[model samples]
Target: MTAPVLEMRSIVKTFPGVRALSDVSLTVAPGEVHAICGENGAGKSTLMKVLSGVHPYGSYEGEILFEGSPCAFRDIRASEAQGIVIIHQELALIPYLSIAENIFLGNEHATRGFINWNDTLRHAASLLKRVGLDEHPQTRVADIGVGKQQLVEIAKALAKRVKLLILDEPTAALNDGDSAQLLRLIGELKEQGITSIIISHKLNEIAEVADSVTILRDGRTIETLDVKAGSTTEDRIIRGMVGRDLDHRFPERTPYEGDPGAHPALEVRDWTVHHPIDQQRKVVDGVSVQVRRGEIVGIAGLMGAGRTELAMSVFGRSYGRNISGTVLKDGREIGTRTVPEAVAHGIAYVTEDRKQYGLNLIDTIGRNITLSALSKVARRGVVDEHEETRVAESYRGSMNIKAPTVFEQVGRLSGGNQQKVVLSKWIFAGPDVLILDEPTRGIDVGAKYEIYTVIDRLAAEGKAVIFISSELPELLGMCDRVYTMAAGRLTGEIPRAEATQEVLMRHMTKNTR
Candidate 1:
């Protein structure tokens, strides 16, 4: 009904080792919720950076026409001055600052550099109300969950008088209820004529709120579809994003149906773990789960369902305090109390948060790859650097770690490649059970397929793979059996044949009381 509010024509951007974007173009209607969908490293973020002045003018060859006027923003401030605000995947809030301070930090309303606390609080409070956040403006940013933090970020954007809001993976950390609330807030923003460009991997979320969709692969625009148009569907969008008919995003695996009953390789009895913060709170409430040898067992639940806590506690009691759990390896009471003891008893836990918990970013890839089970390369408390080098080099080739050399920094590598290092490190540890938490969280489709293949191989080798993921489809696809939890309690266990999204959702919400 109206001309496009923004247009990017023939956008081409390149980095040292990768062509981030090539011949990409997009048009966004006024008051439209436009979603940009692609796997990680597909250049969706690059396109947004180009538009938001993050990449800056002349860094890429492109012509951006906003409101029928060609403009080149030199920096983030320049773009923000024009009422364009971008919220990144990792929020940029100052942890020590209060909600009000964070919201009006740069855009502070002051008279001749004089303090204006009351005005700032009032402004921040109004913005918070607009974003449907009930928290007081004086609340500390650190004293909030990730979902509330997201709302605070939105409030910050609203304080900046944002016309075109850009959200990157906004709901990635949110629970189901919080995510639904955010979606509703976006819808309300649309009704108020606020244009939004959202970059996300969750296609269902995009489908719910997006008026139009754009797919990018390897920094190239494949297609942009109007939601009102007849041709828009999840399958169509998936095809455009991945360049293939993705009949199933989750690869089907045969659950443990071969033998009616089989001996579980890893078994736990009366596993009770106290909260690391609050000793009285039982984070893992007397739970028990067993994974058979050569079987993939999935843990599915909402955020804070104790799924991660359970895994961390069982895998060498790495997280919890006052942990009393009985772990039997092949029905043998070996007693895994410490991390080294767990590793010795054939248990490896590849952490969920890969960036923070898994790898040493500053260290070389070789070092991080051989961090666990160093005894293989260490003798008399001195590590054999040669053996470490050889092992790292072998994994680099076998795991297909894309880097010039094994000496390169793990942080310097791409997300997919860093994940390979994590997996390679664990697999080399020689564990009977591998606990992978959110294995493919920030990886691309191609990389995810590779990781799935690795998991498949582990299963084929008769190793118990305990997979924990927030995504139900991922659990249903990769696991022979799925165990759903709620409120730190085991709610239901579904075999592959009976596991459906609907059934899992019901079980996931089983512990409302």
Candidate 2:
């Protein structure tokens, strides 16, 4: 047997009131694709941060061995110097910079403190080619799609001459096709004898690509399964992560049978939105959608199909230019020309990009939850601190936020907890029509189930929900009626009884006149 490439022994990491990891240990074999599986807040990211030196040495109790040698890295640079590179779940690339500039941001091709543009571009071009990206090296990062941006991140890692690569939810934001391509790229990297440690909530992907799996639960290492041994199915992984057998991926709900005479809770008439940058291009072309009370309506589409544009444009013109849309709530046309008006009219939009648009990470949890509806907790233009704390604490318990207190900064919470905070803010706003864009994007299975349960309860209380997701299975599993969009047009609509993956996909791909 060959020596392990990396080993972490008796690792312990803690925050002020929370022990993130407790006596956790992991071993990765050389040239193997190893997967770290756990529920959100189960210490996967914390362990990786420790390894990558994001937490630094002397801050935790652990003995790390790399290439059979004891090493304590003081920072990320020290780890990267030994050919280890970690790409975080939230991409670290600067949006304003060009692809070449982002690839060589810190590790530049320079001489005597002067950048060599020629050398940098030349090296970036080669790296981009190696990652199968065809975009020009000088193209702005913001102009490219998320899939391409992911490739750029990999190119950046390659520039460091990485021997061991760690990817944290690399495909969380990517569509299915992009995800497949990335998994293939991982396979290719494995073929080149590069060891990889991938942390992901997608069990199927882990089952497909991982050679060995490590399961962590409540900050403790449970067991490591050898995939080659043939007992490491996705269901098996879920059982380990959640500490019980999960018979179904989705919770059961009473189906919403459509009624022609019933009035919709929310409706859009002949909505159209031109592209924000290019006014000549119509992103959403004459699209119409409606959701009845106590129903969950799903929008299914490929990336760039303008599902997000439709949602944002309807929700107070948060996106696009030249937006011409008539929004009706309870059969009455409401004027939602701005965000405050939209909220006043009982409409809420939960953005897909939580970090950017959903919550204020620097603020306390209580503050973020009260942000959308401060008027409720305010008296005479003064915030009622006691009332605010009471409301926030109520939601923290009801929504299962999992934070120590409402005083904790939202940025310190896990992805699942942050999403709960976003949901809590809007739910507190008391919107009759709620648009949830990719609500379960990067969360784990356990957290997803919790969110789904909350959505189901909301619908049971007669709140109309607009659920948009890149994952078709999620739509098929949760929606009462599914609306398919392609090329910025509403291609088809299917009832839950009639909706299947095949039907939704066909409609999603069909061209509209």
Candidate 2 deviant stretches above 4 angstroms: 257-260
Misplaced by over 4 Å in model 1 are 112-114, 257-263, 362-366, 373-409, 412-414, 444-446
Candidate 2 lDDT over residue span 1-513, tens digit each = 999999999999999999999999999999999999998899999999999999999999989999999879999999999989999998998999999999998899999999999999999999999899999999999989989999999999999999999999999999889999999999998998899999999888998899999999999999999987898888899999999998888889998765768879899999999998999999999999999989999999999899999988888899999989788888999988899999999999999999999999999999999999999999999999999999999999999999899999999999999999999999999999999999998898999999999999999898999999988889989999999999999999998889999999999999775
True-structure lDDT of candidate 2: 0.94
Best model per TM-score: 2
Model 1, span 181-297: residue lDDT tens = 999999999999999999877778877899999888877888888876656887878778778887766556655554546557888877888888889998888788988888999
Report, for every candidate in turn, its global Cα lDDT versus the true structure.
Answer: 0.86, 0.94
RMSD of each: 2.7, 1.1
Which run of 10 residues does model 2 get worst, by summed lDDT? Answer: 254-263
